[model samples]
Target: MCDGYATHNGELAIGRNLKVAFMPWKGYNFEDAIILSERVVREDLFTSLHIAEHVVSVRETKRGSEELTADIPNISENATKDLDENGMIRVGAHAKTGDILIGKITPKGESDPTPEEKLLRAILEKAGDVKDASLKQNHLTKVL
Candidate 1:
């Protein structure tokens, strides 16, 4: 029954954890989220909760399986672009899976864009897809 999923409150990024304790949609109150979660739990329909932050996504699955017969699979953001003290945009995947990241966005005017922007640019510059842009280490960390 969970057909269309969108941001709870804050602007959705790329890979945020939906099950995060501090979800973006707090305005609606934890009660709302909890209520929905409770219903789903009792029904045993959507076996898991997920999130798509501007960086990572938290989802549920067996070991190596796609298509959520219970839901959907092969699931997959925005932050901003910015430079660090060393003037480097740290970006990557922070999922619990073994995904890969590949790309590098040329720095812009230098206001220090958010992680989302940096990652987007990197993707464009290298002409890559979201599935491939995995920053294994550094600023971006894959939770898995």
Candidate 2:
């Protein structure tokens, strides 16, 4: 029995397409992305090949009697946090279907302060100019 599985060499953004001469899976020559696009759809590999700064958009293909349009979908990035000045992935970074394209890392001061940090800052401000006073959480007080 023939195995119904194929490995993709590279991944394309869901809405993007790369013109190719031939595709191994289709066993034919075409002017659009072949196996990569199928993998994107079959495997449901949405966004980011392996990391941030990359995404996979579902490709769109339509064939008409006189016209053929194959529009690839746009890649969706997984990272939603604020990026540091130098924390973005470099341009022209090549990644395979299962490789890392962009690695996201928030810098120490780039991301918004956590709720604890904000609360601490507020408490510190409230306690400002008071030498012997410190803020403490009171479990006995119930928020209405």
TM-score of each: 0.16, 0.16
Tens digits of per-residue lDDT, candidate 1, 37-118, equal 5655677765544433444333322211111111111323222122223322344324233322322222123254557765
Off by over 4 Å in 1: 1-42, 56-96, 105-133, 136-144
- Per-residue lDDT of candidate 2, residues 27-60 (tens digit): 5555545344566667775654432222432222
lDDT at 134 for candidate 2? 12
Weakest 10 consecutive residues of candidate 2 by summed lDDT: 63-72
> Candidate 1, TM-score vs. the true structure?
0.16
lDDT score for residue 90 of model 2: 35
